[model samples]
Target: MEESNRIVEKTVHTGQQQQQQQMSSSLPATTPVVNPSNPNLQKKQQHIEDSPIANSLPTDHITDVDEYKPPTAEEIRRLTWKRDLRIIPLVFLFFLFSFLDRVNIGNAKLAGLMDDIKITEDQYNGALSIFFAGYIAFEIPANMMLNKLGPRVWMAILLVVWGTILASMASITTGTQLIVARFFLGVAEAGLLPAIYYYLSVWYTRKEQAQKVSLFLTSLSLSGAVGGLLAYGIVRMDGIHGMGGWQWIFIIEAIPTLVLSIVCFIALPDYPEKTGSTFLTEHERKVLLDMLRADAGPAPENDPEFSWKQFFSVFKDWVVYMYCITVIGVIVCIYSIGMFLPSIVRGMGFTSLNAQAMTVPPYILASITILINGHSAARCGERGLHVVASVLLSVVGYIMLIALQGDSLAGRYVATMLITTGAFSCYGSMGSWFTSNFAGRTKRSIAIATINCAGNLGGVIAGQLYRDNDAPYYIHGHGAALGFACATILFSLILKLLLRRINKKRDGLTGEERATIIAEEKADNLLEKHPDFRYIL
Candidate 1:
């Protein structure tokens, strides 16, 4: 009776979700990985295989195969929603401090950090922006190593490095000193975001990753809101001896990260395969592994070692490029506003306290925007619409700020919320898009690292975009940010169209033929061919 019920449930749900399993008659005659007419796509693909990109990382070698088997809706939900959610809060809490450590410097400046250090204005700006230089240098290697090292150790180690550096920053007396420390701090923090995304992929299927990405990425918003209160409160505190508020910003915030590091060492699980026999019973382990295997095929445990051919394969994929470009434009809008919003608010004639207070609203809006779109995307198995909407919202926000000259407190306040909401929403949506589009350990890791590395370049540029000369109005900053938002729209359109074309080409095969193609695509594993995986919308 139990076996009969299980069979009935799987059939009913699978038919509802994927009735059109057979490829349609009008599909392309032949769909080759290589194309002649599209140079940019060809170059993007070749770029993955050439020299540094191909040889530089671990994501190139293994893709566990799954056969196309129709999973019941019950099985789909079990893998993605339940498993993906468990690790999200963990990533968010860790990143909360990670972002805080980076941006709280801006908060510190408002609290008179520059004055306390006796630094020139230019030097202070230099210190604030220097972290990106270091961040860009080590991102890929760090992410490559992150999976090999595993999240439990890698994340904690990264936190310790950055958190310790953050604490050490309090002792610096000059701008030069601060810049050097921040540079190293960036190096330490470099792999974390991409690595966490990659790590999250191991546990959750592409179908489940969107909401989880949003949940994890929401830390940036939480950081904005909570960092303000923390920065506002801590900077004002009466501390030991004669240390100022910014000094405490370092010391106080660094402590929690340190505490979490220890907790991470104790509490975090490495992978299901290495089940240590203590935390989860054998039955629970089998259940969890069954869910992942159902969705992603099987996690190939015994495999050939990493190779350049495989590492370069990700670059050839094309999806990563679209993901990277789309994210770069949006992240610029995110960091540009983030880097300058406090200063912009202060420039509008409000005191530092009031300016800080003004930032709170944007973060509130950002938190909700990120989570809602992300959750919807994950639930509906969609990735395209939310990303486009997020960018469109940003375009509106950017146009409003750039086209209109506003000096009123309410006007500047409103602009901040609009830009923040739109930019952060795009960020969350893009993250969901990223994981859903890539498969296999090698491909996903390199894909995430490469995309993030490109996106961080925008951070380097954002530091320069906000000019001191435009202080009273900052028209130049608003215009540049708007331009990037428009670029975001372009990339979004291109990515959506490109993926749609790929989907159409594959649509011609029979259901069984299509399953065979996907199984081969997932790599050589025989087990992964029949999972009935669908493209994350």
Candidate 2:
């Protein structure tokens, strides 16, 4: 009995000593943000963002989750920033053009594509529908290729191809030409977003990803709002006087994309080992890497070679299935910005020009909300509630749109603002949720591709649902949006419950039981060796 008491005392003392050590090591070697300081956050914002490639090592390999691993910290930090700096700007440009080219058909519509191209309304829908056909066919393969090729080569190639397709839009004269240009563009652009998400997983721990992703994704909102304004400005130039407004939108937009593609190739900073000259102060670099090592384990040095066994392994979890369905519902409503906002606005009494003008404000509100929620979630270490709040906000907006009628423009306008806010609010939260919950590069890659494919499928359904006959109110489409938003809320709750069960199962196991659970070590949390470690639910 005395010997057992001694053992317990030693264990207690060892834990106390480790806690003290952690507190001390948490202080930076040099004050972080020691140079490029923001006055308000200079002190408290010691937390840093790493380049994505810095953390390619496995997490469970760390000796202890609670104990500080300084060498590991530095390695992860440098790797993460290297990947982030290279990848974010490149993917940002890719999505910017993908979104702009796909949706600007609406801008062209107002500019007279329908009358000038002699496109029948039915055939116009067919041309628009074909983009997703290509989008669907290529999405998974693009992401799978992204997993294999790495961003430096794959993303740049993706940008060049998509930009070429966008430029080709300026030359299209017939409905068939429009159909082919848009379809091939969709195929070219298909893998970029999934690839970005998969690539981010290579560098960041789940907690670190949201704000960085938010910064890039807000580009989508900007494109939605700005794409039209750009079209408006381009169509006004004197040298372009004889060109159709649609042609001007395509030509001018493609020029910037052409330049953006070239810059992205050189500017992209891939994995940490591949990081260019030290653009970041050593202190800043160090803090960023340490943060992710503390959050998710390091990214694998290189993705494991593809195998049929691994490919089939993605079905082992039910979360992947739930997430697949949840994303389908989430994106159905979320796509309102890209797929429907302009059309819905045009359906109102506004002229084609005025309709294009109005799509800007809602997305401006969306960008603001996304930035705020993304940073807030990462800061406070909370994620799900924000999504719930955002989706509920969307549901309320849809309700107002359906109940309030077009007579109340103020109410309709307010609803539009809320819709953008809520949808993107959830989008910003949801991506990180997937990252935070899943483990392993293989599973993460498959899950990302799966969710994205599911989400883009929503675009296919959403496209056809908004009918010309339902104009002014779009009663059926609005109702479909509402139903899907509600479904998202319920599924989110269900997922929360399942995760709680997962946590409970985790908690009930004894150390010996956990260690003996028969899961593969490389794939399981090595940090499970620590009692306080809990999977983020």
Candidate 3:
């Protein structure tokens, strides 16, 4: 009986050794073995390679198949710098154009778009609100298509379509035609911001993301500044060739987008693994892949097969809904300010051209505040406090707007600067906060789209907030903005406390208890629900 048992054990050992050898032989010839001296690094590398997602990838997609010697920290820094320089600027330019096209209707409105179309104030507000209806409807599907078609092809097509629509707005002579153009314009612009957010999330680590988000989003303010300058210049062309200044605004802004569409097609990188850019060497590519995987764990978008179950799973998380609420509150203020700042300034007694130019300073101040708050939040690794600070600042601004009541032009103008600065600052930190909490790539994509979709309802609210009858005071608008900002602060505090409680509970679990929990999560394919996965507050 003992001899028979030994023979069986020997046979099992031999089979296991053979399987291991077969697996090793399948890898590339130059692939290096994990160092025996560093047990922790070896375990981590094995964990990554043995993950289900990793195993499902094609052999060529595995970064571990390259030489295993990790790059030095300085080398990694240089590679990151090179990657950022190439990627951020191009996407920045694209988003700048996207934002400009979406909101330039405001500039056109001021330059006499409503008069040219003979539209009533109610019809104009309806046109504004209708754009967001198309925008909200198409976000999820557009992001799904973006994943399939690749960013370059998908974004270029979108830009060209929207730019054409914008240019055609110059010819619309009735409110109905303008409304139709605005809706299609919204449809074309839907995927852009969310797609870019997802793209940046894929490229950067959690610690690095807020700063990058700030840089990308600073374009919002920069567009305001540049758009203001451009509007001031273009509106002067009102009488030339019998075209209205509003018509000239649309035509001139549309030209750059059309031209940049061709540039985007040629310039955008698909993904780090699939990029064919001559600028990145094989070593740099491998290092980058390694860094990203280590920092954020496996991304679901990297999975080989599409799962409807995975796509729908994002809706089950309460965190997503909470994020949506906060975003809705923030967007209400932002869209309101974006759409009405010039008018608000004009109501404060500035000339039309001077009002366009005056929009520049507030936007510039907002841009500076966004960068500072984003950098500070990233450095401190605290998202909630930063967001709360920004909201409170806006609350102060709204209060001033209410109390001052156009009594002091300088005071009201300062309030405008505070409003822009405070509201814009929340975007970078808040966006990074929610994005980092999601584990899977598809979930992150859907979460972002859904949040933006829900949040855009704020734009509808914004369109109606400042009525023509309100005129100079607009107390209702100011009060409503103040209410939203306060709501954001409350929501942010609740979320932060909830995350803290959850983290404490996780911290108190025993090793074996945590292990079992992780095993259960893995079995259920719940990536971020693992005991080790802590939410960023």
Candidate 4:
């Protein structure tokens, strides 16, 4: 039985009320009636339509054919603001702390971390690389678990688990211990980024997604800046308790994540369908549901509540791999910068503490650029061009870093800014692009997890790129970064062309042909290949 049918049948309530609740909780949010063929059932639906709840909803604008004239621009703007207030702040803080904990090792290294741990440069690199081992291995499984357990319970659990692991890092005395802790830290932290992306998709439409995701991606930049400033102050507490500044950075930063775990459990909502009346009024809930369903198109009659076959089918889609390939190089660039920026700045002749401070300006510029790029993409409804432009900028930056003379300090610093801005901006535009292209919920979930897991192989590579032995003008590191950024541009253009070709082919089909394809796919219980569905370019 479909999950929605099972839900309606099992609930011990009046049939009309059960149908009403089911509409609130069900995917597709199809029009609710006890039964279309029964006269009594039709009356029940009419009763609902006449009720105060339905009266306050946008149903007056809904036509008999199930088309709803969406909320006006002003109404959508107001609702979006309300949603932003509820969702963005908490997730933003969660990712901020999560990223800080992950990358503060760069700051810690500046505070004599390797000296205290007594590790060689190769061992330090091994420690960095191993984190992604756990991260990549667990990402898909973690997202699957998230779907099973729901975001609130699973996210809160992950937060606490990763926080405990991060705090434990302060006591490690050997490179192997650091490697082990960092690995588990990756294991515990793996679910966070992909899960948050999926969660945001649940709330926002495609048009709203790029800007919202960019807002969230800003945490990466903010965390970099925040991590640098915090390290500047906290490292000054060195030897206060006979611990190195690196140790203090680990211990102190882990505290906020632990606190936020409680907040996540108490406040983070799961899905629009699952939210209680106190969380969202009936009118607001219905409007939100209508907006989403209208934007995505109504679910087909044969659409299942969930399908394992569809979940696994993402692997068969060639576009999924294209997404994976496009992101791999971008991930390498992002991880390389996040994990090594402070060290890179120090190599530019700044003092250890001053390097931490100097990392702030580039991240600040990148954050601003991300917000602007995101809004522009969302407003213009263009992805490939924005992504190409941003990454092209990074390519230029990498070229400058590799080719500039050693004495050109100002030139090198400017190159870092360009790298940060371009690479960081890619996060939002590219992410929203691929995610919007995938069709069904389960398929999208698996595709996102797969693409992210595959892309994180770049993180493993990043750990090896900028070795301590290759400091100051690390030719190999800058050269590899340049090559990867170029690969991103290449794959992005290719993917864009491929999607456009597919969309153009679909557009050539007649209405009857399109209907036939949808019908056949529905018979197979697949939802992602509707001929009428157009990919976002």
Candidate 5:
């Protein structure tokens, strides 16, 4: 008995000594309570303390725990600003022209694309729907390529390929040719949206991502406005070099894309670790990485050896399908608006050029709303409700479109503002919401790709909805979009409730039981399924 007692004492003393040594190295500062006055700082400190690395630290080291100082808010701000300056501009520009290239076809239609090609209304709709065939089919493969080749290389390549295809549209003489060119353009651009989401996920934590994504995706709304102004001016060059005004729109817009592709190759940062030393100092890199690990558990290093098991495991998650369903509705509304707004405006008794220019105000307002919604979501740390609210706004707009009289052009124009603002705002919130929930890169890539693939089907549906025959009011299209918007609200609410229930169930577990489950999950590479992982609603 005495010998056992001696052994216990010795073991306790050794553990205490080891902890002291760790405490010495880990927490040299004497500040017991730094930034206690700021609630955000305190919350951040608590978050780090709850992380796996922090949980592994010796609990007996009370002095070390008290003295520990988390990175200051200023440091985080500075590093974030540095990353934003380098990363967002390039990605934003790429998305801008990619979107411009994609939707400029709408502007081209107003510029007499159909008249030149002699395509009937049904054939014109077929051309639009055909784009999403390549878009949906290539999404998974393209994202797989993004995972294999680093984003910088793959994104630059996509830009070059799509720009070439878009420019070639200027030469197409038949409706079938236009359809073929648009399909290839879709194939090249498939990876961009998912890639941008995944790429931003690498740099920022879940909370920070919405704002960054919002700012980046602002290009979606702004591109419409920019496309309008550009189309307005370019269509005036009808006789320039004997090319049609529609040809000029395609050729002129494709120039920026080809030029920017070179810039992307030269300047775009690959990954946080792969970023140049000049861009992020070693110390800054370490600090940034530490913050990431604390927020989400330790992510694998950039370009970790690909695992087939991880790649295939994405199909097991049911939540991704729910996300897929919700986003479909949002995509339908957005694509319909983007593809047909000019036509709709023209149908309201305006000339084609005037219609092209008028599309600008709705898009500009939508951009402002997107920024505001993203900022609000990030600040409040909520996503589903914001999405719900935005979708509701769209429902209201669609109602107006269906119920408002034909001569109420002014009222219909305001309805377009509501629809554009609501549908476009959902992109950033929805992208960040789900992308943040998945942990591993392979799982994230496949899940994003899958969700995107399903969502792009809405593009196909949207193409069919706003037929030329359903001109002016487009009651059927408006009504269908409204129904889908309500569907979005339903699915979003369901997803939010399901995630909350799961989180609540996990919270009910005993500390030891929770620890055991987390260990098992970590061993099996269960990632976001780990008990400690909480989904953001």
Candidate 6:
């Protein structure tokens, strides 16, 4: 038995040496060697290195292979919960304020912003549309900065700057001033959503991200609900210090955002590998890193240094454009509903204060739907179907809005609930789908920024969709939103089919062919081009 044990140990040691040699060829020889004298530690390490999860990562990316041990299921669960507790609430509040500052113009309009500024409806719409001009222009650059400065510093800077700009809205006396403030506000806020998405991607695996993203994004609906309630109260403060209710709305909302900016700067973790938090033990950190590497494999993009070539190369992918267009459709519905819900409710014959209060319920309903759809997608491991179902629900709501009579107040209100619920739920799935589909951190960053930028163009489209001319049953607006919803469904199906076809082609290649392709791609540092890099459809 002693001789047999010695022979097995020899075989394991030989295998470890071979693996270490293989890894060293692709990466620097920096990994510490495991102590062969510690038999139990050696056995545990060997078991982990042999596991399917460890084998999924490329050798070049396994920096701590000698030290890795597979975390127990309970350990992973507890760690995930701890991460959720630390990250979700703060990020959620940040985005909640971000979204509120963007859409609060709608609340302010109902509180007499347009009349106070002496702007025509067309000019008001122009102000709304122009924000996206700055937002789209800065998104990619902002994400590049976030990658360089790290999430904590970059995001906090953005939050504080935008919060200051958002407050300055209370001081604008002319349409031009309001327009300029809105534009700069857009520029300041541009980096935040995409930055948060990228930050979360680095921390969590593809499977774990959707639900977390949903929780974070629930801030959108919460902002709508909370903004409505706040607006209801603030509007009553009209003429206080000779400022309009709209001005009070801007001032009050800005205060909390500025406070949170300081909190975020101090509290937010940079990245898992660089985190200085006491919440995670050294072993937990190692396990987390290994899990992330295993989930996506490694690429040159994982390196801290920025690559302009890799950044621009994202534009070359047809899949990226598909995702961009798909999100645009969804964002059209979301922005239109979010911007116009108060107006839509007021048109149903409610007073201004009652309309503000009325906006809360649909958003509350939407928030509930978003959580359900997000969790269900994660649980079922499906993306396209859940997104399609949600958008179709919006289409149905739009159709009901068009068909139902204005006097049928309760029914039309139900339709509004459906619209909010459906439109909001699609966001979480679409975000997770696109983020996971892209490989490489730099490429993923640019892809996410581009998609989000394109999607925000929907805000421009939405600004013009619901005009005063289309008053009490805005058939044109409803019809246009319905069309976008259908387009989203069509685009999602096409992308899914295309991905499946590509995955199928990959599966049919022989081992030698795949091996040759992988070697050639690896030589070029084209990680996504590797034959084994499967799409997540």
C-alpha TM-score for every candidate: 0.81, 0.80, 0.88, 0.87, 0.87, 0.90
Give one digit per residue, the lDDT tens place, for model 5 in 1-537: 121122223334444454444344335376355378878768766775644334323332234444454444455567778888999999999999988898888999999999998999888888889999999999999988998898999999999999999999999999889889989999999999999998988887777787888999899999999999999999999989989999999999999999989998989888777776888877577666655654564334243556677778788889988999999999999999999999888887899999999999999998998889998888777899999998888999999988887689899889999999999998778988888888788888889999999999999999999876778778899999998899999999999999999989877877677667756654337677766567888
Candidate number that wins on lDDT, 4 or 5:
5
Q: Candidate 6 — which pairs collide?
A: none
lDDT of 6 by residue, 92-155 (tens): 9999999999999999999999998899888899898999999999999999998789999999
Sorting all predicted structures by TM-score, with the top scorer first, yields 6, 3, 5, 4, 1, 2
For residue 166, what is the lDDT in candidate 1?
92
User: Against the hidden true structure, what lDDT does model 6 obtain?
Assistant: 0.83
Output the lDDT of residue 35, model 4: 55
Q: So what's the TM-score on candidate 6?
A: 0.90
Overall lDDT per candidate, in order of appearance: 0.70, 0.68, 0.80, 0.80, 0.83, 0.83
Score candidate 2 by lDDT: 0.68
Query: lDDT tens string, model 1, 166-207?
Result: 999889998889989989998999988987887777765555
Segments of candidate 3 deviating more than 4 angstroms: 1-66, 298-301, 521-524
Error of 6 at 508 (Å): 2.3
User: How much is the lDDT of residue 118 in candidate 4?
Assistant: 96
Q: What would the TM-score be for candidate 5 when compared with the true structure?
A: 0.87
Residue 322 in model 2: shift from native, Å? 1.0
What lDDT score goes with residue 472 in model 3? Answer: 81
Count the clashes in each prediction. 19, 19, 0, 0, 0, 0
Q: RMSD (Cα, Å) of candidate 3?
A: 9.5
lDDT of 4 by residue, 21-66 (tens): 3234333456433557888657655665544334323232343423
lDDT of the structure predicted as candidate 1:
0.70
**lDDT of each residue in 1-537, candidate 2, tens digit only:** 121122223333444354344334333444322234455443322221121322232222333223323333344345455555656666666677767877888777777777788988777877767888888788878877866776767877887788778877877878888888878988997887787777776666565677667767777777788886886666555246677777877777777667766776777655543454555445344444444444443222234555444455566667778877777777778665576687788766777677777888988988888888888876655666777888998999999888888479888888888887888778878887776665556666766877787777777776677778888898888899998889888887788787777678767877466445424454333322233345454
Comparing 1 and 2 on lDDT, the stronger one: 1
